[model samples]
Target: MPSMGCASAIAKIPVSKAGRKNHNRHFGHSEEILTKEEHISAMTIEHEQNTNIDDGEFDQIPQILFEGVSSLKTIGCPGTLIPVTNQTRAVICGADSNNVIAAASLLGRGRCLVFAHSGYPYMFINVDVEDRRFVENCRLWLAKGRNAQFVLIDDTQSLSDVPLDETILVWNGECIKNDTFMQNLHDYLRQGGALVCGATPWGWLQLNSGKILSDLPFFHFCDFIGIKLTENYSNCSNPMPFQLELIQFKNIHHATQKLVADPTDIESLCIVGGACKDLNVDVSGLPIDILKNIAMKAENEVIPSNSCPIQDKCCRQKSNGLCGILCVLTSTKAPGIANFPGDFSHPPVTETHVIFHIESNANEWYCTGYYAVAGIPIQIDVLECMGAMGWSIRIGCHSDHLEVCF
Candidate 1:
């Protein structure tokens, strides 16, 4: 409803406002509220030697929000959506050895920044002087230039009233069951409206029936944005499934360069990766020898087993399938690889259409998709997923959209 900047725009995004009570109530002023000296001492010991925000561009503007912040002390936590640090659009702003403290990116026509922790207004109570300066700086930065108006849609009930302007729309990952709301979003994006749609497919699946990508209420929107949610969840211990690389998509999509950021921060941010049956075709019963041969014989190919380790699971599951080269294997007849060693009638499976794999992580979780349209399409990246907790997408365009993302 008001003009927004990068950092300020995030505050207006429709995230849960729970856990806003003062931390003093949870820790009791006597025990948890450290005196200035005590607080400084505790945080000093925790700084580089113990804190996770030690490395990388922590000095970046986003780190100001964490200044003087030793640890989170809150109650009735509403949880948070873990932003995917490795996607094409996301830029890791700050992180430590364990997690990403902050990330920023451009989507469609707006900017977005995400942090792993929560507790807003209350957390701002008794802020450090320097930290306060950081807030003021962000405000000043916005006033200086990025004073674009933004809209945060808390519910689909108000979709009909979404303002007609250049304002960027931020959708709170609420599932849209109504077609009118879906149509509104579709038209909005088509008309160059910016959007930040949050998603929590895995969390939705916990309370609902069926698979995440298909069952989640915001799925139609997910498809429109070329994002897919997987059942796999990542944490401090697990690693992200896909490598962080800005890709230059073929055809009408433009190429762009990699935004300089810490790969560790990027990897630490993605919390979900899992095999989704809907995103891949069944290549289970296909002969392993031919599949391996196809993977090898294809130009610029590597062994499928080595490249796609998930095939092992598919091998064991029998009913499930392997993707990538196998997807090509089922649909094409490679010169040397298509034929079995001897059986003349058994030309390895072939189809009328070739299934081209656009996403590099297709072997990992099959969570990204591509669709071609008549006009220039909105090229977006699936920044992160928090399973049932929800996910988010940023839409904006800059001059350097040609950055490659393989």
Candidate 2:
């Protein structure tokens, strides 16, 4: 029997921590103190409210994983300061004045809960009941509604040896140079198998070679998944620099951004392959000036075109008239329509690739990808235009199969 995907069940989570000496130096303490032990105040943010399932309402995966628990008392530890990628898809459940302590990420059909330092393991050195309970909650959240049988894959074994249908692969390796593994992984995702990737392909590519190769397997993988990995890296202790503002949801027949009150509801999938709108919700149309602004941003690479046969096909489905929205295409190359900007489908589907200029380290790093939203389903991409850079929130799905990346 096929088990759930990586974040759903079996997985390997990497934890990055700073050295003790650096930790002391960072806190402005004397080098003589071997260890600095102090309780930090962690504030919790409520991203979503629980819904009553019995009332026929769609229940959302609690964005705040640490429910009822306000804060955790821990010895001031040094861990990776994880930046928030997407607000709707992830929640900073716990955070001190300076850093994020705990969070939960909801992907396609899988869920993952993350903590700062050696979370559960740290309890052995100093026990905190809240930490223990939080760890327990993380366990339940990941393992909920599934069996727990796991398989370990090392250099001795091949991914082909394991049944793709029966496993969810968690790959945290530095780089995947193997051609066969990449091909198999692509097929697995198309078949609705999920994956949890610790590092981005650009992280590997930039370190190896400064240029991106279109023929590379990693390039194909990112194209297939509708994500663009940049050669940028986040600076030390910098919080997330961008915020996504939900634009107006308009014409299901032509718009790329789709909003769902509840992502888990299967009825939303009716608009999956087809762009016809069957729902009776009011259309908060996108502003014309905003559309022109987006076009102007991509003016260098975006060529204005009105010859979309797909839009014509979708317009025939309903009585709604043709939307006169202009279309833009990126110059990036891949195998298929993944790079084309259009109203594709739902969460985890990237409609078009956003272009970014490579600059010096004076600017912060931002990567673009698709993530399933909790309260509302949408996708986020980092775009720079008119000397301003921020997150561009839109909805699109190019994949026929449902899978998620972490």
Candidate 3:
């Protein structure tokens, strides 16, 4: 809910007690805490590297990189429906590199900075040397922007040991106990920082053993987790079938709800390119494409402008297969009319006392029938009528002095 500002400005804001309380409620005390020295060391290493190309030509870099840089802004994790600024960053740790990479790609296209762990691929796909290199390339691209930074964290360390003061923490994979690290992570997130995370299927099994899954501070720290603690089930699956999915928070309908209470604070974000199908197959033996389509539809349908009546009306008319009429009266005969493309068809024009009927159904009115206007008014019924036949219609009128075709 805070305005997009410099990272320094964000860091200056004091952590609220409520945030601390929330953190305590989720993650219990850990044995190994991250010393202040370690945190500093990590940040130092991250800062030392110049991820950007030394050549001043910004155009030399891949467009994806530029897009990623542009998208950098304060993003509410898991619930990153709206970007808060142009330099926000996401911190992903302990997850498979593949899922992180996929998510990073989506976020980057949206202009958000992504900081992910350099561990194993998060998905089931075999991540070879080339794949690993691509992941690193993404990091470099993200680093090029003044708004982005890619921090490669050591997997051996627990998430709790890492500093999460002003970052949106995405904790994925299995649990690594470090009470101090958890406390800091929780504190950072509870103070209005965003987080998105998911446990591995194996971790879910462990949780099923009466381990009090929801009791973990990180579980409650995030706005939404892939899995449900109380129910021990996940509404989503890994290797998501779609490039991006809109995560719905409790009682929030609009995507901008996470950014601000105002209706105008949100903007449309894009899902450029990434693997959309699930890496793991389901029991029905159906292709992952089905799930991918479902997710894509869910995400795309939530565009901020979708609430506008005019937009909805246009979409509705298209769905009903009705093209609006555009009438033009010309003095040219036949006029060597061009055929409508395959995407559209031309309607037939008959001269038998044609009656254009506008039928109203629900809240919309559409042309439903056309009557023949023949001499002496002979009624003719046509089974099918095509609307908007062509750019122009031909009319023939005969007079006593001259035969005119218009």
Candidate 4:
């Protein structure tokens, strides 16, 4: 194993491109043949908005982080794992397996960025945290590579001390009711810094709207990010529980793969926020020419509005037994996203219209490009369930009741 001090040598470590031989081919086959105006450059991002770091020093990490025993979640999608680049070295593999729990990606100019799935609630005090590798790895990852000689943060250090650099930062955590944390994140995004929140950046926003209510009507964070909470799918049951079979995970989209170090079998993933798409970060933007020109004209239209008020407010169920603080990716605030209930824990829900379906489903519908939500695994074909067989279909962002029916 390479020592932390030898980051230069570690960056030079030879890694094999064992499994990613067909990325380009796959994208080519699935192309929608977008027009010139549709393809946004990653650098020319249009952000209507926005990190604070303190010490400006790197944290020193102990080798023990790579030595912990583990129990990994092969359950729902843990957010698509980024491709294990030929340059990636397993900083910490999970228990009894080679599944990388923490990894480092050495980019150009001797810059190194590490990703550790440990700062969140689930991984915080679990067995995976035996040596505090998880938390430290995240802090260390943000230290800005090359100059990052220290791998462990001091007792007084936190992400607050990690200086905010202009980069893509994903705040995938449980919940954030703190004002300081919110402000810190706010500052990061305000400077046109790319930030992806697939989890709990909306706790404060939701609280503003009312816990029992998911409207998330107004907030600068929501406006600047171009998104707002609409539902908490914990109550949206799959009605057809017995019929549904094995859990299925949606693969990380091609556009999002760059966000993670080695994007592979990743779950616990939610849709990318609209702000992320506008910023041209990791999210795969909507390809809705078909939906706009053809689908909408057909009467079965999916409009993108800011009014989706759900009456089946079953807030007790929770999504997959986890908090489902679902939010719409758009800034227009009405309520909910296209009448789609917040709860996917029950039946009648086909995970077909996942994050991938956002743009294709008609960006007008506030249904997705959701943030601060949990992943769901289900059976049943989407077309079959929606009863879209030879029927006029229109899906928009505003609604009062059933989203789409036969």
Best by lDDT: 1
TM-scores of all candidate predictions against the true structure: 0.35, 0.32, 0.28, 0.27
TM-score of 2: 0.32
Which sections of candidate 4 miss by over 4 Å? 1-131, 144-286, 290-406
Model 1 residue 324 CA deviation in Å: 6.4
- The sequence of per-residue lDDT tens digits that candidate 4 reaches over residues 47-143 is 1010222111111222323223232233221211221222222333222111222333222212233222213323322325343643344334434
Give the Cα error of residue 379 in candidate 3, in Å.
67
- Ordered from best to worst TM-score, the candidate numbers read 1, 2, 3, 4
**Model 3 C-alpha lDDT versus the unseen true structure:** 0.27
RMSD of each: 21.3, 22.0, 23.9, 20.9
Residue 358 lDDT, candidate 3, scale 0-100? 27
lDDT of 1 by residue, 1-406 (tens): 1111111111121112212221121111222233323432432332323222222432232333233333322212222232221221222211221122223322232233332222222223335553464334433322223433445565547466866464555555543445556566555544444444444444555555323344344543432232333343224222211112311110001110111122112211111111112223211222446444423443222112323332343232221122232332333333333222333344444322223222221112222222221112232332332222223332222222323311
Q: Model 2, range 1-406, lDDT digits (tens) per residue?
A: 1111211111111111212321121111122223212100000111121121111111223322445544444423323222222211222312221133333333333333333332323342243564565444444444453433223332414566876554444443344446556555544543434443333333444455323433234333432232222232222232321111111111121122432333222222222112212111112123445433332332211232335333443323221111112221121121222334444365453333334333332223223333332223122233332332221222334442323311
Kindly list the per-residue Cα lDDT of model 3 for residues 1-406, writing each as its tens digit.
1112211111110111111111222345422344333432432342233232222332233334333332222111221111111112222211211123222211211112222211232311233443444434444444332322233232636655545333333445345535556555544432333333334332443444323433444343221211112221223233222222231111111222331232112221111111111211111111234323322333222322313322464333222111000010111111112221112245435453344332221222222233222122132233232332111112232322222432
Residue 92, candidate 3: how far off, in angstroms?
14
Which scores better on lDDT, 1 or 4? 1
Q: lDDT ranking from best to worst?
A: 1, 2, 3, 4
Listed per model in order, the count of residue pairs whose N, CA or C atoms clash below 3 Å is: 31, 3, 29, 65
